[model samples]
Target chain A: MVRRSREPVLWAMFSGGGMIAALLLPATVAVLWIAAPLGWVEAPSYEGLRLLFLHPIGRLSLFAVATLSFFHWAHRFRYTVYDGLQLYHLSQLIAILTYSIAVALTVIAGFVLVTTG
Target chain B: MAKALNAGYKRHYPKWHRERVPIFWWLRSASYVKFMFRELTSLFVAYAAGLLLVQAWVLGQGAAAHARLLNWLSHPAVVTWHVILLATLLFHTVTWLNLTPQALVLRLGRWRVPKTVVWAGHYAAWLVLSLVIVCLFVGVA
Candidate 1:
């Protein structure tokens, strides 16, 4: 019998998160930070943007992006410290700490999204 | 009756590089450091997402809260941070898109898609997304 490791599952999440981040983050940053602040575009009113977020789809989308991005960070940082810093001996501890923070932040994101009405 | 061929065979010891990799190995090579910087951008990506969450929280609190949050975000330090993050995020996006073909191999029947084609597809998708976002933000769509 062959045994499998859980690394693949984490890698899948990381890859998925990468796709989402690549597809979404640039446009988001452009709109929120660049276009709006620089006045290159007619930025939405604060009330309008907030109303959009209060909608179910907007909240869900934000939560998904946040959750995936955090997992992406967790996976990347896990390798960064483990391999980049040559801390392979502390792999288990590092993974736990990194993943724990990601999960905690994800929960905080969820809390902020759902309760922000 | 087999010949004694084994009698003349010699055993050699396995050789190793022996030299340990230095702690700052990435600094020695531009390519290595570039790769490291690409990997490092994930931190800022996470930061951007977390900041968005905070904005959502503040927006939920009400107008004054959101106003204060926006004001804070507009500070010089915050603007500088955003600029840095935007650059990293752009790098992340470009590299991720460039590497997409390697990760995702699309097949049609017995034929495999060419990497350049796949790369072009990713760029096209990115262009469409950015345009749509621009339209939405500018009230063109």
Candidate 2:
């Protein structure tokens, strides 16, 4: 019997994350890091931003993006190391480490999102 | 009888081995280099998500902590880093969207959607989503 490869599941996450990052990260980074700090856009008051994040929808969206993005990183970085670095001998170890880190970060992000006001 | 006669074939035959690829092979071609850079964009993606997570964590700490994060972001070095991040992210976006037509083949009944149309649609969606995010941040929405 052939064991099923889990690559498809990881690839799905990778593509989904890539899509979300492509669609959202540019504007998010531009607004938060560039425009807001430079006074090109009105920066949200800390209280206002906090209240938004404290809302359930805000928390859910943040969690979704952060978690998917991390998984995207894990899948890509795993292949980068495997092929780019030619570390085929350590494939199993690399897969484990990359996905584990992604999962760990997701947990931390979830906790922060849940606890934050 | 044939199986018994061929039982020692493995011992007589030489093993086949794959040619080793050079570690820096991606540097040899422009396209390969671009692909490597595209893969490298994942790091920036992770960085952006991690930064947002940190921001959320800081927001929970207190107003002073959140303010400190904003102040830190305004520093020259950090701002420069973010500029690089934005560039890399845009590269990722363009490359990813360009590949969408290949990955997704749309059919309108018997007529297939034109690749150009599919490609343009992705770009349009990307533009709209980006605008939406910007509007959210700017409190326009």
Candidate 3:
């Protein structure tokens, strides 16, 4: 809260985050490339370990692009639940819901790459 | 009484938007702008939900299907739109990431939460998430 009241910035962030969320459907197509499917473009990968952090520069770049973008969304969504639902009394609950879902989503991505990878 | 006052504040501000380019005019009235920004930031939730869904679906699909998905994703027109969309979305994320703290705790009686920490924590999380994504994808691929 800015000494007086600062809700506009928050609202802007909310709208911006919503706009960004619109990109996911198309971005999902990139999953094909990352997965190395037969006809896919191979734009990015989320495989695992050796290549994950230690691999060549190319791999690092791909993960960086995908992950950074992902977290940004994570941060944005956490607040959405709180203010959007007017769960005014459930701030912590909303926080958990927001961040946990992000964690779960990212974890699921990792799991898929690990098992199928 | 405080709640009533606050409600009046919202009614006169962004919560009850009266026009189309509220954002454009928002700059004209700093107070209104701030009010609107707070509401707009919620878009991130939508962005995250979309990304997560993509992750789940992509992971479930096999190589062949994944490949087809990529071919479509890479189309020149598609790529252009994707880049434009990503840029705008990131704008949404970065600006809002800076506001998460206050948003999390809009008000706790008279004790309010600081937004700086909220934004910083998000940046930190981005770094960690980035690393984790790198580890998983590079290794698997």
Candidate 4:
């Protein structure tokens, strides 16, 4: 019933890729928290995955972080817009447009990483 | 049978005041607890970025660069920042985990998991995961 009910437009923003990004964030942080002090590798680098940080894996990681982060902000911001701005006519539209840009920017970042790599 | 009173309870309600207001009320509501968590979660953004910078420098110069980055991070100012950011991030992560169920559409048969269960499960998972990670680090060290 809850699912079938008209979900608050703000809630919809979280579902399509936004939720995925939110879920990804903590996992990535946990990984960083673990990877950093543990001396997982003898030396880290900027090169490719095998070589260092500046590599493909690093670039991919950067893009992933940025993309996910944006989506998280987008979803949360939608709620803020909804509650703060009493412009009922425009709230839903703003939410949609915000999420659209967030996803689009995320995609572009992904493209950049893959192409560059 | 209950009699319908024409007048509303007690005193007449005061007229609503009109003026432009600030967003501060948004921060004070109980529901804002979730928003606070979501807002605070942005720390992960900084965490990831910081890690990338360290790795970037390290990768660009090899071992020496990596070592220097580590040393830089160890500075008192940087350490203080890391400590504060780390605390904020963990709180956000934990709160987000707690709220995941409400945000998600999960059902078992006709019954949905209680929000309490959902929140507790997240805390349990986090505890288990963090413990395991800490153990691995300790073992390696």
Clashes of each: 0, 0, 50, 9
- lDDT for B135 in candidate 3 is 43
Cα DockQ of the candidate 4 complex: 0.22
Docking quality band of candidate 3, CAPRI definitions: incorrect
lDDT of 1 by residue, A16-59 (tens): 77888898888888777766765666766777777666679889
- lDDT scores of the candidates, listed in order: 0.83, 0.90, 0.48, 0.55
Measured against the true structure, the TM-scores of the candidates, in listed sequence, are 0.89, 0.92, 0.39, 0.55
Candidate 4 chain A has its poorest 10 consecutive residues by lDDT at: A41-50
What lDDT score is found at residue B39 in candidate 2? 97
lDDT of 3 by residue, A50-112 (tens): 233233453334333344445545555555445444556788786667556656755754544
lDDT of 4 by residue, B54-127 (tens): 45444455556656666775566765665556666656665667667777665799998888787777667666
Fnat per predicted structure, each in turn = 0.58, 0.78, 0.12, 0.12
Looking at candidate 2 chain A, the ten consecutive residues that score lowest on lDDT are A46-55
Which regions of candidate 4 are displaced past 4 Å? A1-66, A77-117, B1-19, B26-40, B43-50, B53-57, B128-141
Best by DockQ: 2
In angstroms, give how far residue B132 of model 2 lies from its true place: 1.4
| Candidate 3 second chain TM | 0.51
Candidate 2: regions farther than 4 A off: B1-10
> In model 2, what is the error at residue B92, expressed in angstroms?
0.4
Kindly give the stretch of ten consecutive residues in candidate 1 chain B with the minimal lDDT sum: B1-10
Question: How much is B26 displaced in model 3, in angstroms?
Answer: 6.0
- Provide the DockQ value for model 3: 0.12
- Residue-level error in angstroms, candidate 1, position A89: 0.7
